[model samples]
Target: MSLTPLNEDLGVLRFITAGSVDDGKSTLIGRLLYDSKSVLTDQLSALSRAKHKRTAGEDIDFSLLTDGLEAEREQGITIDVAYRYFATARRKFIIADTPGHEQYTRNMVTGASTAHAAIILVDATRVTEVDGQTELLAQTKRHSAIVKLLGLQHVIVAINKMDLIDFSEARFNAIRAAYLELAQRLGLQDVRFVPVSALKGDNIVFASEKMPWYQDEPLLDVLESLPVAEQDGELRFPVQLVARQDGSQADDFRGYMGRVESGAIRVGQSLRVLPSNRSATVAEIVGPSGLLDQAFAGQCVTVRLAEDVDVSRGDTFVSTESALQPSRKLGADVCWFDEEPLSPQRKYLLKQATSTVYVRVGSVDTVLDVTTLSHGTDKTTLAMNDIGAVQLSLQKPLAADTYDSHPATGSFVLIDEATHHTVAAGMIRTLAA
Candidate 1:
């Protein structure tokens, strides 16, 4: 009847499983959830009653657990991002199951933006041996590149459906060697390869007896062992709301409510209000339980300023020692998502944190060919799912950070004024000096 609250004490690993179509992303997640006893009895019963048949030939379709959308189930492809949360004795996990289709590459970008790790699935059957060299699928390389572009340091290349390959160690080795080359080319720092059979639960939650030669930790163990990426950066708090308590002077309070995007906040700290350039001191840190002395990243709290120095939603409270500079023009890396192509003539809404401003596409510098990891010749318009380097001119100045600096402040989304749909996701690369 109710959802279980996220256990912060247990530590959460936010990761995504992404690959080409039919690579068993949803099934892998389903196996992790089902085998780990995270699924309930009624859900299991519902699986039994489902009409969709799986190749595994059991009464239940494991993909049913994650492929909740009718369109996804019908097409047998993931179109939108499916987020699932599960926990084990050692750690809790938030898994983003992303689409594998090239048309939905933006969905992969969206899912991986906040993830600490990425499990890029590769179908063992798709591995081709050409003159003693392994050739990888384009989708696999695209997903891996996008994962790195999004700044995910920890990557797991899961070669799924190993059972189909007869659990061949040679096949796994070839794929691993080829992937290591790709990882090196992409500058991926941490990558691990694992052989899994999501359909039959091989090397998923437990070791598969079928492949005793592959002596690495199971997928669950790798996930459980990975250290949750530490949130470290300058203090940046984008105010979402300014709460005001009315009725009595005795309880009169003005609290700025927002989540700590990065760094830490504490009582009696000097805070700087961005754009407006006003300064204030932190008088109190109010949390759900009571007043606290300090708060870290990811904790949403209400902060009472020592002085009312003109603040509201869309304003940011940052560390006075180091603050972000406000700018009107920004250079960014954009992942275009709309069906309609992006052009310089179009006017859209740019939303970063709590701030939304009118913006126009200044120029298309380079359109990246994800397959080859090179820039294409097109510099005019960005097509659907195209990654491009673009310049944006904003009507109002905003305090922005480079994507490499802090993801929370560096990331933004572009909204079409007419359709109100998010047209693109952008990561700031540079701010006009």
Candidate 2:
């Protein structure tokens, strides 16, 4: 099978590593960084002198490179998301090492929210074989389901600890078959498999001679070659702050300041402000360096509209020709993160992009069973770490798009009004009628 060509303009690839506990997520990342010579001299010395070394005979414990928390080191498990940066000659990378435990699913969601791809580490030893059928761990299935729900562009399943299983080709095939079934059920399209031993650095940065049956490129090469998710070419500029210069010597200036979440904006372009449905033409586009003729996605700029319109921090500037519409009712898939169950009666704060509005759960439509990869409508309450589809009623309309089409503007979080804590993360699936 051929791989997708990488987009050189993407510059940096952001990805998250996830799996069950002791599945070698952190170790795999450590191996990638160490094998690619991304580790510095001081870090290497510290690894040698550190006391929590898991490996024997001064064989550097690779997991120490990540797992930086004191409690994480003591427990030998990742509790919080740890971000690390490294670069190869061909591409730069940002890795989010997420916790594998089921309780920390929120952290995994947080890390995966901004990532373009995911590296799911599956322990070969964790799978049980019976009559040529393999059973994957519950956490592994749950992570894969979450990957599909988040709409990740690429998924690389690194079957880790090949050395522990004696590099058996039959075992690898069985596990791959089982995972392929799961991927098909979860609707994961761009999936690739590689057998690796994070401990021994096999098939991580270089091809492992022991696994000669595996003809595919190593994990690093696959990552470098995978295409990044392209942002849609519709302007989505959420107004973060309304800049004003009232007492200046020059004429009074009013500009809407924010980062271009997606798409491009240029002078003379027509834009429609959200919720208000006010139209205006772009008069000036100013960047950090000074005036700019045009600004694309991920750029922070201040825009001056030709006509003064009532724009605020929460207002979004959208392309006049774009299909996105303002809606008060949203159909979304939400992952509950709070200890309290989802209460339709309680008022919650819905924060999407720069806007925060009061919202209520209109109804719980379906709850996902990660093990079976099925949705059930019989459920009512969603406890902590539960994934469910629900209809939300907003006090005000939001200019939003479906998460599958435009992730930056289509995602939101539910905040508890009483405690001021985020209770759930939601992805828009449908709009108001």
lDDT of the candidates, in the order given: 0.88, 0.91
Residue-by-residue lDDT tens digits, candidate 2, 64-150? 999999899999999999999998766889999999999999889999998989999999998896675798998899888888889
Q: How big is the positional error of residue 214 in model 2, measured in Å on the Cα after superposition? A: 1.1
178-261, model 1: which lDDT tens digit per residue?
Answer: 999999988999999889999889999999899989877888888887876686988989999989998468778899999999
**Candidate 2 off by > 4 Å:** 1-10, 130-132, 247-250
Give the winner by TM-score. Answer: 2
TM-score per candidate: 0.92, 0.96
lDDT of 2: 0.91
Give candidate 1 misplaced runs (Cα > 4 Å).
1-10, 56-59, 130-132, 246-252
Candidate 1 lDDT for residue 420:
97
TM-score of 1: 0.92
Best by lDDT: 2
